[model samples]
Target chain A: MADVARLAGVSHQTVSRVVNGHPNVREETVLRVRRAIEELGYHRNSTARALVTRRTNVLGVIAFDTTLFGPAQTLSGIERAAREAGYFLSMVSLDDVSPDGIVAAAEYLVQQSVEGCVAIAPQRSLVDALAALPGPHPLVAVEGGEGSGLPVVCVDQVQGAHDAVRHLLELGHTTVHHIEGDPLWLESEARVVGWRRALEEAGAPAPEPLQGDWSPRSGYALGRSLVARRAEGERVTAIFVGNDQMAIGVLRALHEAGLRVPGDVSVVGFDDVPEAEFLTPSLTTVFQDFAQVGKESLALLLGEIGTERNGSPGPSATERRVVPARLRVRGSSGPPPP
Target chain B: MADVARLAGVSHQTVSRVVNGHPNVREETVLRVRRAIEELGYHRNSTARALVTRRTNVLGVIAFDTTLFGPAQTLSGIERAAREAGYFLSMVSLDDVSPDGIVAAAEYLVQQSVEGCVAIAPQRSLVDALAALPGPHPLVAVEGGEGSGLPVVCVDQVQGAHDAVRHLLELGHTTVHHIEGDPLWLESEARVVGWRRALEEAGAPAPEPLQGDWSPRSGYALGRSLVARRAEGERVTAIFVGNDQMAIGVLRALHEAGLRVPGDVSVVGFDDVPEAEFLTPSLTTVFQDFAQVGKESLALLLGEIGTERNGSPGPSATERRVVPARLRVRGSSGPPPP
Candidate 1:
């Protein structure tokens, strides 16, 4: 520490602050200290630190369906946040999304001596399981929404869903049809609620909801059914989809059916995933700040753990944060065909 | 064990074998025993087992960019394999894929008391770093090819790439353009090698490859440049993209340019991801056995670790296993334009 301090013309306390990832340090000074530390091959030995503090210096993450775009992005965010907080992240994934699955995974992570855990799977049943688990460590939920009795950080899926459906309704279309996400996820249910809410307020009949498993294939299949209905001369002018992948499916189905998006059928999707905008006509979708959700999830967990490394008790009462979703209007959606 | 046997109407040994995930057990018997265990809330206490056997019953995995389809599937594979072997899996993802980064990640895992570790990142430098790290724990590599002084298991990228290019060449194309993946991945370099080799054998020109960072955007960008070259009346007939995500990108760009796929251009992609079949013109891709890779990774690591849990030392002379890759013919690629 002293060697790095002398090399960077900084005091020992400043070097400690930089190494500990203190946010108050000036950016340029942090860079200078980092350079000196790198040149000196100075690494804050986590093992030695663990011995002194009696804490593992490891944080645990419980995520599910990591192959999906949203969960994958959130997991990445949690990892970045943990690293920046000077903690190593250890993760355990559930092959099954059942409550028992969460319980088993939590038990495993808890046994590994994780100082804190961030549960990243957002199904209601999983949240219930998380709430029921006896934890010796602080736990936080991302995308799990509120009412789990644990601190939660999430993008408001309900509002995001509402914005998407309302966009279609406001496009002068009498009714907006929706294809929702997996039933296992609370996000899916929340989206359904938002879609129904928008329709109820507009005095438009909320058509019997269709279910999708969050795959592009499901969207395509469901879109094919809707196309069949359109072939029968039904008024299906506008649609809102649960997520981008399924929307892609719907787009492909509509394309194959010889219908033009936003012309034959105006469409809106959720989670403006990176590929969403680059789709042939591009996508008009809701964008959730998943990265912020992840960062806040970890920060909340650390606060619960009450570590001096990330400063004093994280938020004595800062239990939940709801990140707002933004809508990106792209070429895929517009006024209903005259 | 005795109680479970009595409850399930099976012998004590049968109950033990089933609990341990022995492959020899009959399917029906396995189900019966599992039901009894679940109904009775029987859980294998890993901590107690660790104390009795001096093994942590825990394994470590080091991966990178798991959000990508290939790595994410492999990580899930490893998790499944580990659980089936009655071991808990702890994974640490490297935000950066480099020799130093991998070394640090490995050191962290080693300190966490992992009995064995699976190195899942596929960068050559990472392999080199793994070879250099001192470790008391056993180690194995997946998607990492030979000569790393450690056991390596991987899909034969060279063969896969060669097959993809050869398929294009045999279609009577004069030359094939390649969009390679990230330079940091060994898979990218191997694919490049295979493309060049196939072109050499066919006595055809292999254009200097364009690079992609395995995103749809990069693929779309590279695809647009090709579109421009085609507009200038250059032969841009066949392209072999690095992965399906990029292929989608190229497909979008080409579609926008009014190029008739298979009539004016033929494209082949790697990693037959789930969405490949549903793309506007379905994608033809190389399918690597990531599940096998994951299973063998853990099996090999356990063999190196040498315990009663997973049987013998995997390969006393553990070298490498090259899982074969298959080419899936879909709608995207066809005979080149006359």
Candidate 2:
């Protein structure tokens, strides 16, 4: 530190300010200190600095099932947002979603002295586990549905599903059948609610929704069952799948059954996955701004952290942030069996 | 420590050993200490412990483009392995792939006093930047190709590509066109090498490869272009696409051009994503065991860290570990049109 200060011809405090990214440091002085530090290869020891300043500038992010597209995209969004906010992330991804696992992950982060935590809690169990934790650390949940009394940032899953159903109904379909995602997920439950509500509002019959474990194979299986029902004289004119991956399977099942999409059955999916646009019959689906969800979660977490640091009462526990879901209509949805 | 010792009827050192997970502690003693600690809701301060024992129990992971399937899966695998190994990950995902960005991420991890780092450096620039870092910190590269003298763990991309092409040639394709992934990636380069080599060995002409940015849209666009070449009297009987997402697009393109998969065109892809099997004509693709790659990278990194701690010379810089890729033969690839 002394060598960098001397080389930069700056005072010790000025060098510290520049290194710490203090806003008061002049551009020229910051440049000089940075150049000197680079030339000396002087990397600041964050551990020692953290001890002195009591600020680690590190945030914890607990995620689950990151191999899935939604969780994975949300995590990537959070990483980008954390970096842009000048905070590093200490990430813990739980392969198994259990109460003990959630508590253990939170405890681990607390031990690391992370300023706050953001959990991608999409399942009710995960949200409950996080809400039950006894700690002073600030926490913000992403896609954690209501009633846990924790601040949350989520895409409006119900609204997204409702829109898809409404679009299919307006296309002259009397009713829209749904292939629900894993029943354990809060997202699946919410989408089911939306689909049911839309059907009720339209005075249309609501058939029992088929359950899927959010896999393409499950979708394919359930889709084949729907095809059989159609073969048995049931009206299976339109289908709303829980996610795009499952939707792909549904498309395949319908194709194998010689059912032309929109020509015989209108298919809709959620998650507007990248390949949605190029499917055999381009999919009409819901788009969740996963990155926006991430950004909003970080902003909420930072707010809580700031309140804690300032010794001020934070926002209400029920604070909710909803990133709106958009419906992207394409070739898969059209007039039903004209 | 004193409180836990008193409650557990054990010495402070016994409690310490139990808390630190040290061996040699009696099972009864460990259980007693744990119960006491749980009863008191005791949580160890990792920062202080790190300062005293100089063991942070944290490993740094610098990743890039994690929104993509390959990187995302690899990261998930690494995360699972790290937890099993009892280490927390300080992850930095770079949105931009540049030398300066890589160096900055490395420096950031160093500041956190991470014991070692595993960089998911699949790009040439990333490996170069990591290799250029002037630090004593142990580093391992995951998916970083040969050269640059770094301990690397990666799937055998060349062999995977060779297997895909060989399967096509064995099925009686005269020549197979290629749709390579983003050119800057080492995986893309290596796959192209394997594809070319297989064609060369089979005494087939090597047509120019189309470059796609690993997006389904790019695959759709390139697939249409291939369709055009076929219209112009080119033998576009088979195509080896870079990834499954792109393969989906190509299938749609072929279908639109009245070309039936396996009947008029056979397609193969890499990465064997979960959706591959559920695609219209279940995609024949290469399956990279990302979990194994993650486990191997962590093992290699831990070996380096252990060597550094023991003051022993570490393994050779060019030490390489390759996980074999399996060719999943599905319905998509078959004999070319007669």
Candidate 3:
């Protein structure tokens, strides 16, 4: 510290202030001090410095541990944004959502003195747990409920699902069958609502929906059930799948049953993942910009840390950022054949 | 420190020894000190403790950023193993592999005081960078290598590729075409070797290999080239695709060319990804046990940290740990039509 202070012609206290990222330092003086530190190869040992200023420059992230399209892309986006903003992201997975288990995970980060937390809130259990805790540190939520006095960045799940269902209805299908995610997930519940709303607005009978656990095998099982019903002379000309993986399984089941896509049934899916384009018939699905959600969530957390505000313009401003999804048309969707 | 000392009925110096993870303490004394710290929720605020101990309990990882099957699976496996072993995994992606770029990516982790690093050394440039660095930290290279010295944990890429080709030969294919990854990768070079060795051992002429960038589009382009050659009266009895994504593209291409698999040309792919089973004709491919590799890597690192030894077991040990690959025979492969 003394070497740097002497080299830059600054006092030891001034050097400390510059190194600790104190906002009050003059830009020119901070620049000179940084140059000296770099020249001296003086690594600012974050552990030692954190003791005096109590800021670790570490941002804790709670994310789902899956290779599924949405969460994985969101995590990548968060890493990019967080690194650019000069924060190190330390993550814990919420693959298991028991309150005690989640609490244990959060406690581990809290013990590490994380400056702020950003929970990738995909499930209701996670949201409920975060809501229960009066977090000792600043907190933000991603894909979570708005107006908990905690900032939330979310994709417009209901709107995206509505867009997909509306696309199916516009193709002249009298009714559409739905395969929805586990009801425990907020996205799944919201998507079901969107499908029902689109059907009600069209004055069409709401067919009973098939439930899936978001795995391809689950989708295959439900698809097999649907195929059996079709074999018994029931007609389902269009199906809206909850996600791309399930849509893929449905396509395979229909193919094996001698039904040609678009000619026998039109299929629409959500989360137009990379593989959807490569599927034999191709997939017409809704594309959610998961990377955008990740980027915005990171920006929100940094905004909160710097100014103690969750990136809101004001209380009157929108507390929620709902990124919209776009519908991508491909070979799987078409007007009812003949 | 004072609170912990009072709770443990010891002086501050003893508490310091416990916090530093010194192995000199008696077992009973260590237990007493740990219990006191847990009761007080005292983790020594790693930032503060790191100043003196110089250990961060964090392992930095640099991997390719693609959502491709191999990298994604390896990352997931590493994350699982890391969390189980009480280490934090901080990852950065290298989108390109220029030597300087690889060094910069690694320097980011070095600056964070990661006690060790695991570089996914795939390309020649990355391997060169890894070799050049004067490491003050332990490094375990995973998945690729130029030369073996610094504790490498890798599956037998050449052997995996050989097994795929041998399986096709056993199924009575007189010749098999090869599709390979980018030429820059060590695995690609090794796969080429394995494929050639299989043909030479059988005294069959080496078929010309097709180039791909480990993507479905690249495979589709190469598949089209093969279809054109087939149309010119050249026969392709079988093909060994570099990965399953490319195999899917080749299967689609064959269908479009009116060539039925097995009846026209059998296909074998590497990396039996989740989607392989769901493809129109389920893919027969090579499967690497990434979980075993990940678990082994974590165990190796922990052993290095706990004791001074690297992956080489003590003198008493008779065998080295290596994760092996297996051939999964599925619907896509069969005997060539007579």
Candidate 4:
């Protein structure tokens, strides 16, 4: 840098500024510094250091931000945990959640030498691809349901859903209607299973669940349709929505239709989103510990990939870690339509 | 390669898998390979390749995913753009948005040889840390206001805020009540400035603006306080919230208080988030082109950082690129109550 500075007839600080891409440098001086750098063959030294250490201390993740509450918050948790553990986190978020896209994104990261991976985009095909490859580094699927011959870390969505439905049933609602999440997600299917089980055990008629693509728009449309169905003679009271984002839409749609929550229709949502409590009648919802899920997912992956100085074989066997979920009963759910 | 496999008594594919950290390899096979690697004194070739080429082809970004709509969407846009340009995107997302935290995060990336950096957490001190680096790479501040001495690519928050206020004014509202975003963010400050300008230009009484921490809960509290103030003889007719998330809270607070949107009070919001149009009355808000902002930020950074292959000197003059923002007048805003 000093050589470049001397050659370019500028201070060392100016040379540093030119090299760092500071926008305030004069164009002519920038050009002179570049010429000096080229002549002197100046370059930073991380590459050489990396060659010796063989460790980048970076972890790769593939996640989908689909705007639902869980994925984004979970990502933050993973980031915080990784930083604490002295590893950097980078991700290739799949634009196309298809199997092909998932596999291609993984391959891209593998080439970059990410020590290990935690995939938050949990489509079956993506899970299958991760299972088949298995090594080059460890792979753990967060929220991919039990074992598919690979390590997995998931929130107990079914347990959370069961608790939510049971809460409504305990509140004296004969049967709870449900708005299911995106069909593609395993969490959706698990929630459905939990809700149905609760209904069956209670001997209440479990109506076929309404489907929502996990958007406020879908929730609004579906919620309004449910209200219409109720008006047409079907008894609809308590609703178990897929997530709080959709629950927002449900509350809005119900509000617009002149249905007072917990008075005309009770509502329970999953994912206890930040806005859940601030809704017209605060939502009664299931809370998933997304940060815990993220932290555990990283810990599990690190267990396999091992630490920077110590590369333990890391649990070579397929493993599963289930984080707990709980239900928070707020104003939205109550005795059905007293 | 043949020698290592033969020495380890494993298939060449097995050696490759072992080297890649593929988890399915037998523990015994991994040990055998490790012995062979130690004997051969082998190291990964990517580091060697990096030293030779002087380019990692990886772009580093320090972003704060404080879970707001704009920042997250901007990140997605940046990921897409970087992938298209064949530059792998890695990020250190600061859970702590403090300036000290921001600078330390940048220093961490500098040691990794990221060709360039984008700091989405645009605090003044963070901007200063980036400006002083004057490195062998480049830096750009997305949504960092002008005269930060950094190349800036930002959505026209001022224009967007102005448009939001103007729409309400043109709708014949007496004055628009402003709900400001977090004070630390340049966007928040910019929006406040724009709101004041619009109110002053329209000759409307710019009653002291309400403040929100850019969360629904905060917005709810602030909104409820305003409603209470109005109940105590304060004349409040229209409101412009900082972001869509906060707008949702305000709408909910008003609804619970027996106020009808656009009929009892008018509302407009900034950052027209995805759920904005799906909200109860469909929010009338300022639409920031976040994807465009992301693209322009990367483009500006690349112009300063130059390509990995040519290592050409890029622009030295301070540059500011402002993407356009427009207002989407929806059902939430109408002529104020007579």
Give residue B3's lDDT in candidate 4 (0 to 100): 79
Ranking by lDDT: 2, 1, 4, 3
Q: Could you give the candidate ranking by DockQ, starting with the highest?
A: 2, 3, 4, 1
Q: What DockQ does candidate 3 score?
A: 0.42
Query: For model 1 chain A, where is the 10-residue window of minimal lDDT?
Result: A43-52
| Retained true contacts (fraction), each candidate | 0.34, 0.86, 0.31, 0.53
lDDT (Cα atoms) of all candidates against the true structure: 0.83, 0.91, 0.78, 0.82
Q: Name the regions of candidate 2 deviating beyond 4 angstroms.
A: A1-40, A313-316, B1-18, B21-40, B313-315
What TM-score is obtained for chain B in each of the predicted models?
0.83, 0.92, 0.85, 0.84
For all predicted structures, in order, the TM-scores are 0.81, 0.93, 0.88, 0.85
Kindly report which residue pairs in candidate 1 clash with one another.
B303-B314
lDDT of 1 by residue, A252-280 (tens): 89989999988889888999877777777
Q: Which is the winner by TM-score between candidate 2 and candidate 4?
A: 2
Rank order by TM-score, top first? Answer: 2, 3, 4, 1
Report per-candidate DockQ. Answer: 0.23, 0.76, 0.42, 0.33
Q: Write the per-residue lDDT of candidate 2 for residues B126-228, one digit (tens) a residue.
A: 8988988975378999989888789999999999999999999999999999999989999999999999999999999999999998999999999999999
Q: Please, what are the lDDT tens digits per residue for candidate 4 over residues B232-287?
A: 98878899999887887998889888999989899898877766776678889988
Q: What is the lDDT of residue A95 in candidate 4?
A: 82
lDDT per residue as tens, model 3, B244-286 = 8788788878877888876788988888777677777778988
Give the C-alpha interface root-mean-square deviation per candidate.
4.5, 1.2, 2.0, 2.9
